[model samples]
Structure formats: structure tokens, C-alpha cells
Target: MSCDGDQHTMQSSDDVLPPPGDIQVLLLTLDSVSLSWSSPQGLIGPQTFRVTWGCDGETSSTRVKDVHHLKISSLKPGEKYQFNVATEGEDGRQSRWVSASLSTVLPAPDQLTVDSVDTTSAAVSWNQSPGLDHTQHHYQISYRCSGTEPHITTTSSPSITLCDLKPATEYSVTVCTVLENGKQSQLVLTTFTTVLPAPDQLTVDSVDTTSAAVSWSQPPGLNQTQHHYHYQISYQCPGTKPHITTTSSHSISLSDLQCGTQYSVTVCTVLENGKQSQLVSTTLTTGSCPEGWRRFGCSCYYLSTEEKSWEESRQDCLERGADLVIINSEEEQTFINGFEPDSYAWIGLTDSVTEGTWKWVDGTPLTTPRYWWSGEPGGGTYQNCGEIYYISSGQGVWRDYDCTFSQQWICEK
Candidate 1:
């Protein structure tokens, strides 16, 4: 609005100072207002511009010696205020006050909502801020992972989609309302938690009759968030109770299962929140074992390292839930020969009951097609025990020895 620079009320002084003109208010905000006015025309030298303002029934004045404009601050937001400006000439003459009225900025956005949270992204929305202007209205969005610095963005649509989040994560979000007048409302704050991801890509690395090794990877979006991960592995035979195993590593070897049996295996990832991800399952067959015995081919063998007499060795093998070695085929004879090279080991053959009638330890009689050396059993009834002789020939051959001789033996279970 225009104020008269030369126009003034009647004054008796010879040097009459002109009144300030063209008073205007610009750059108003929630807390402060700026005021500018032209200098009075009649002033001869530098003039002191006086700015006086009053609001809520209290008045305060400030004087600047040479500047035509004064910026007033520290006013309450969303409050009404009145301001007045005047010019005091260098001669001590003062002009009447030119006044302007203003109302401060609007209140902050309300009802902040953070929703649709997942491993890597979330959605944010809010209500419009309460204020006098909406022409340039917008919401300033600021969000950060819990315990970290924040990032900011501006949007006029009142809603935003957050990105680059992590699984099982917490975030703090703030929304502020701004109007065309550049006045921002108080910030609205809230927190949100992202959902845990589902573990996938389960693999059974290897499997044996009684044990299996399984491996898996954590679900997507959980790499940075899950500093400590847990794996839950469950396996079961068709009719048995499930065996559960827990470990921090992604790979686990499960044991104590039935051999040659099909088993169902599942792996799940455990989040820091103690929530388990979706289960990934696979099937494998475990290898077989015979109590403490190891199997090869169609039979299981338990080699004994202790030295004992022929009879004592026989009894010891039987006590250990097995039988002494019995050569039934040429291949079997050759295998036994290589098993104990450069040494003699007792076999389950003897003619203890009858001098010329050979018999297996299991009561089977030796027939004419035999695996024996021509000169064996020369001691007649006294050489009644049979042993594998390996030192005298290129390949081992069976020979009858005294039953009192001590040697190492092999047991078949």
C-alpha cells in the first residue's frame, strides 16, 4: 500500500520531514515478518528508520540508523500480528506510523501413517496440514533406519513410497506440512517395522545312510539386517519322529538316521525377531549301517588287531557278534590273501573231530573242490587248524597248522 512521502500533518518547525511511503510486507513465515518502506523526502542527511510492531496487545519498537527495511523475527507461528513503520529525519523529526496486519503460518501435518512394510520397501501417507493457504501445499517426508541419520524428500501428493529398506528392520518417519507462504508445520513422527523375508533355495549337499549334509541361503533383503542368522533343520523317516537341529551356520550335517531309508528334510531361516521364514523342503535317502559295523559289498567286516590262538581267535570273533573268516570262493581266497600280506591268519577250517574229515567252524564239511596247498595237513591229526600262509608263495594258500598257534584274524559280521 502507498504512503505519502511529502504529505504530513501540520508542524510548526521550519524544516518539516516527509512521511515514509510505499510500505510493504514480504517474506512472512510462521515465526517472523519483514517490513520495507521508502525514506521520507524532506530529510537532508542520513535518517534513522524506526520500525514499531504490536501483537496480542503488547507493543515493541526497534530503530535502524541507515537501512530502509527491517526484518522482525521471533514471532509465534499460526498467530495474528500487526506491524508499523515510520521515518525519523536526521533533524529529530518523526513521521506517523504506516501499519500492516498478518497471520503466521499453519499447523503441521496430522495423522501420519506408515504402512505396507516389507523387506525392501514401505508406504507412507498423511493428512493435509492445517493452515490458511493450500496453493503450494506439500508434505516434506523424512525417514531413516532406526538409530541412523535421516533422509528427506518433498511431495505434494500427501503420500510417498519408501524404498531400499531391509528385512526385520525398524524405521522412523517424519512428515511436515508446508503452504504456499513457505510456512512449515510442526513435524509428525512415527515408527514402522518391516516384515521378515522368506528363506529359499534349499539344497541337500550330500547324504549317507545315517547322515546327511544340508545347506541353504538367507532370504533376500536380509543380508545387512541379519547380522546373526539361525537355521532350523528337520528330518524324519516315513514312520519316525522328526529330528530337529539348530545352528547359526547355513550348512548342517544331520546324523543318527536309519540307513537306506527315505527321509524328508526341511530348512528354515530364523530372523532376529525370532520369526521363522517359510520352510524349504527336500527328500533324500540315508545310507545304512549295521550297529557299529561298516558295510562293503554284500557283507560287513570287522578286522581284529589282537593276536590270539586259533581256538581263542575263533571264540573271540564269535563273542564280538561275528564269525571268523571263511573262504568260500577263489575270489574270496584272493581277497583274504591280500588283506593280510606277508603274514599268517587263522581261517574257520579245522579237522579237530576227524583226522581226514575237514569241517568249517560253522559245521559245514570241506568237499573235494578245496582251496588248500598239496602238502597241507601233512601233520595228519595234529595239524588240525587251518590258516592262510602268505610268506612262502607269490599268493596266499590255505595250510593246516596247529590249533595252539597265535596270529591276528579277521571277523565278518
Candidate 2:
């Protein structure tokens, strides 16, 4: 062909530059990559290299002269990229392209948060790393209470709930992203404290006309040495305001309560930080009368079994925080009559202060509807105190009796 002519001729394929060989990724990071390659086999003179990369349908390229390494920056984190390198000759001829595929290191998760904390559990969540597919990645969570070993768990979701945590405890939590290839990102850390635990097994130990005794099991892990916390008890009756008290003891006696009422009692743990736990509640009904006393209407009555003089009986009633029974209404009179139909009992009515002027124990003058036996005041000054007498016919009537007469009596409060 004609080497005789002086005109320049087209070069053969043998003269064309070969592609770069052995493309290697030297380093990969969250948002960049460093790459290097062996220059085409000898026979090259002042060659330039063209490097191209693409990800998510976007492509970019750069040219470097006399260099075997290329550094790519501003790449998206946690993304896969395809790269190619070729050699360029002085005459503008390019070699075939050499290719490689690589994935950038995943980035740490962001905005770590803990919420919805209770005595035994909490919910944690975070924003996943950008450019990573949620379905192709998972999250690893590690948590621990103060002075305890760590616990680890995994979830495909960005959010997870942790259970069986200790109450009123400070916890450290770390979250990280995991790739399908088992690669993990740096751990992001946060801390939160669980709410205090509530008292359990609340019960009314004892109840009476005007007071109640209540007890509960202390919250788990609580000890008397930890004096920073205490139990708060609150009680309320229908149509009344709530009453509150705090005690270090597990049992408390509540007083000044109304008789014959239903009370709702709630107990909770209060921390030094002013945090209160969930409320544990119970209900109880108070008895209308104290032990050995009978309730009638709004009053409590006690009938003495031993016989005594009128003055001695009044002294006993006063010592018992009561006074001799006063028959104020026909209903009361009938009730007293039915109590002991065949026995005589001293009543509150008496004329001892002034003869013939009957007065009740409360110093109120006795009025109409009086039940008097026929010719009852016949004893005159000798019998100045009043008493209830039952005839053989079982009819109860008021009769004058001596102050020293020995008879059973009734007390009212």
C-alpha cells in the first residue's frame, strides 16, 4: 500500500490506545469515592483518561491527564453507582471502556427520638439515611438501663417499641442502619428515663363508721433506703372533694370520713422529679355504726345490758360519748318500745333540775305527744326522773321513777 506516497495514512487498530485495566476502588465513603486503575499497557505517550459515573439515571464525567487515580465527590450517600474508564490518545482516538460497580457507605440515621414512655416500655424512632431504599434496609437498636448490660434487637421499620424496660430508670439507646449486604452505619445515640411504676394490690384493710385503713404492695424494686420517693394516696366520696396524703409506709389509716359512704381510693408513686405513676384504685363502703352499736335513722344507739340507777346510767352514757336516749318522735318512741317490750329502762326526760318541769338531756323542754301513764307523777318529789314502763299488756308508757331506781338504760349519739 503504498508507502511510497508522502501523504499521511490512517492508523491501524493495533495503534489505537487500549482501555485502562484493573479498575480498583481504593476507598468509599458516605458521599464520595476514591478510585485508581493501571494505565493501558505500554506504548502510550501522554495519554488522558476519561472517567464516567452514573446513579439513579443521572450521569457525570471527568477527564484527567497523566494520572492513574480519580476522586469523585458530591455523590449521594448509600447509593449504588456504575463507573467506566477509558484512555484517550493524542490523535483523539479513545480505547474501549473498562467498567466497575460499587456502593457508597451508608450514613448514620438522623433525628433519633424516644417517646410514649411508660413504666415498662417505650417507643423509639428515627429518620433513615437518605438515598437508601426502606425495603432493602433494616435498623438495629441497642438499649440498656443504668448499670446493666445492653440488649440488642432488629426491625425492618424505622420505628420500634421496646418492652420490659425497668421503671424510673435511665436508659441509653443507639440506632443504626443495616444494608442488605450486612454493612452497618455509625451508631446514633440518645437517652430517656421511664416513668415511675404504680403501686399494686390496693386494698381496704379495715373500715368503720368514720375511718378506713388501706394498704398496698410497693412498686417493684423500691426500697426504704431510696427516700427520694413516696406513695401518694387520694380518696374521694360522691359529691365531695378529693383528699390527698403522702406516706412512706405501705399502709395508712384515713380518718374524718363520713359514715355510710362509698369512697374511691387511688394510690401512685411519686418521684423526686415530681413525676407520678399510673393510678391504682379501689372502692369501699363505710359502716353506719361502730362495733356493738346499732344504727337507726341518723343516730347510733346502744342498749346497756346491766341494770343501774338513773344517775349511774347517765354517767356510763357520758363516758361512752353519748347521752341518755331522748324520744323526740312517735317513730322513736315506737322503736324504743319494741326494743324491750317487757322491761323498764331510764330515759333522758327528767324533772330533777326543777320539780314538775320535765327536760331532756340536751336541756330542751319536753313538748306534746307525751306518753304518760295514768297518775304517773303520784310519787311527787320522791320520783323526779322519768322512765319507760311496760305493763303486763305490753303497752309502753312514761312513768315517774326515783333517781336511784336500778334499771337498764339506752344511750344515743
Candidate 3:
């Protein structure tokens, strides 16, 4: 009976299977792991392997046959786990368990947001990932403009400020958590557009009686060709409505402006989304005549306040860089006549060079339609210079006079 019992015990021992060997982690990710092992040497008959994994007081197990690898998924990130593998024979006999331990990669930072944005920079922040050693981990940040190459950087803090970004342009940013072991989490992406930049170097290139030409340069470090925004120009005089216009070009001409007026001009950049930049401003004054001068048909006329001889009056006009008024049309004669009614003034007309032959100061011969009095120039050789005098009928006419006569005169530019 003892010999029979010993044989049975030896048979039972031979039937028992040995555990798998060299269990190793083949792959590890934030949420899964793949494991592989070598089968026990030469003792398995229709046997299956039992894989068990546990984390944070929770355990799960599964069985596999004829396979040297097992993949465990749906696992929590940044958590340490314990795994065990054992061999099971067809007769329900099992071997000792092989144990291994590993930790998953850290999770991605959560709630990524853009705290503030400006023309050339932006501030970004995120919440720290749970269950991580803050001092042992860092974040990798990448950013780029639309359709452009990306820039990469790293930060140990949960927030970072990105600088030198383009204005009014779309940009994408990616943030990822990196552990001291060189493991990284999945990338988290976000996008934002910078505010438009204000135009600079505002200039009023030229100003005329009724119009102005203005130009400006785009802001520095901005790519004008890539941006489609326009410039808004507003010009206004005190107590008047503003004149506003938009243009894609760097220069514009404002027409129908008031002459001799000072205008406040302002320019700003406007994005397609209707966002506007700060305004750049300048001031310009339109063409105007000098004080104490009267404007008429693009010319300025000054009437002398005192009287003098014809030669002396001509000298006075010469000192002022002007010449005696030469009436060229009926309207001009009428304007002068009505300016100082019934007053005698020395005109530029003269016949002193040749009696019976009249000419103007510019050496032009007097033509018909002249404002000569009915019987003017009757003085013949006695009267040499000409003057304008009003008749009792209230009509202004020209008369020959002596060169030594004293009277007021008109100066024209």
C-alpha cells in the first residue's frame, strides 16, 4: 500500500505545470499596456495562462490560450499597477504566479484656455494634471500660424505667455505633459486669433483748397500681403460732421473739403470680423489766403489803405512782392468797381510811352471792350497815366491822368 501511494504522488507531481518565465512589459501608454512572456520549459499539455492586474484596490483577471502576449486596456492614466501571470493545465492544476509592476504615462493637462490676447502676444494656461508630482514633470508647448511651421518650447509652470505672434491671424497651440522618465501624454490642441494692429506713420501728404491726400504705413512686423483688413480714415473740422471712408490701399484722397480749415484726421485698422485697432491721428490745414487779403477766383487782392503818386504806389506794390491790379475781364472790373465804390485808384494802364497809344503795365496793348470813359484820353499829351473814377451815374470808368497824381491803388498777386 505504501509503494502504490508513492507512485500516485510522483504521477501527481509530474502532471503539475510550471509558471511562465521572463514576463516583460512590451509596450506602455497612458491608458494601456502590452505584456509578453516565454512559455514554461517542456511541461505544458493543453494549458492556458491566467493574467491578473490590479490598481488602487481594484483587481481584474482574464485567461488566454496558446499565446505568449496579452494586452490590457481601459486602464487609468498615471497610475501604478500590479500584474501576475500563471499557468493552468487541463486537469485544473496550476503553477506559481509570476509578478511584475509598472506605471502608466502621465495624463494631459486639462482645461486649456487663452487667458488674454493682444496684437503680438497671448497668455495661455491649463490645470495641473491629477496624481502627478509637480516638480518631476514639465509641459511642452508648440505654436504656429496658419499654414506655417511650428515653434516649440517647454515650461515647468502650468501657464505660459507666447510672444511675437502675428496680428489678426489665426494660430494653433498644442500642449502636452512630459514626465521625468521621458514619457509624454497625448497632445491637447487649441486655437485663437490675435487682435489687429494699429496703422502707423500717419501723414497728410498734401492739402489743397478743397481736397487732401493722405497716406500711412502698415505697422511694423505685420505681413500686409497676408492680411485682408482695411484702414478706416476719419476727418473732421470743429462743429462739423466727420467724413469717414475705407480703403485697402495705403493712401487715399479726400475730396470736397472746406478751404482754409483745420481738420483732425484719424486712421485705424479694421479686421474682417469688425474688430478695430487703436486710432493714429494727425492734423492738416487746407490752402488759404493770408490775413488782410481778399480771395477771388484763386487770386488774392490787397487794396492800399493810403494814397500815393502813381510811381510811388507802384513802388509800394513792388516792395510787397506784387504788381498793380490788371483787370482782365468784365467780371474782374465789376468786382474791383464794387469793392471800393466811387473811389479813385491808379490803374496799371498807361500811354506815357506814346501819346494816343495805350498799353498795360505788362506791355500788352489795350483792346476794345475797354472801361475807358466816353471821351477818355482826350488829354492827348497832357495826361500820361490812367486812373479809375466813378461817374455821377454810379458807373466806374477809366480816365487819363497826370503822372504826379496821388490816389489809392490795388495790388494783385
The TM-score between candidate 1 and the true structure equals 0.44
In terms of lDDT, model 3 sits at 0.80
What TM-score, to 2 decimals, does candidate 3 have? Answer: 0.50
Task: Highest TM-score: give the candidate number.
Answer: 2
lDDT of 3 by residue, 201-262 (tens): 99888765567889999865566577668889999999999989999989999987777789
What is the C-alpha lDDT profile of model 2 across 1-413, one tens digit per residue?
Answer: 11111232222334367788878999998777899999788745776987778776667777789889988887766668888777877776777778899888788788998868987799998987766753378889999986788999999777899999877888999999887777788899999888787897998888766778999998876655643689899999999889999998899999888778899999999988888888999998876666777777656788888889999999999998789998888778777776773368888989988888999999999896698989876568779888887664444789888889888888887
Instruction: Give the Å error, residue 403, model 1.
Output: 18
Clashes of 3: 0
Model 1 lDDT tens row, 197-248? 6566788887645677888776776664444678788889887889887887
What stretches of model 2 exceed 4 Å from their correct place?
Answer: 1-48, 52-88, 91-103, 110-116, 125-138, 147-149, 152-161, 178-183, 225-228, 238-240, 260-262, 283-287, 290-293, 297-299, 302-338, 341-413
lDDT of 2 at 354: 88
Off by over 4 Å in 1: 1-111, 127-134, 218-226, 237-241, 259-264, 271-278, 283-413
The residue pairs that clash in candidate 3, if any, are none
- Candidate 2 matches the true fold with a TM-score of 0.55
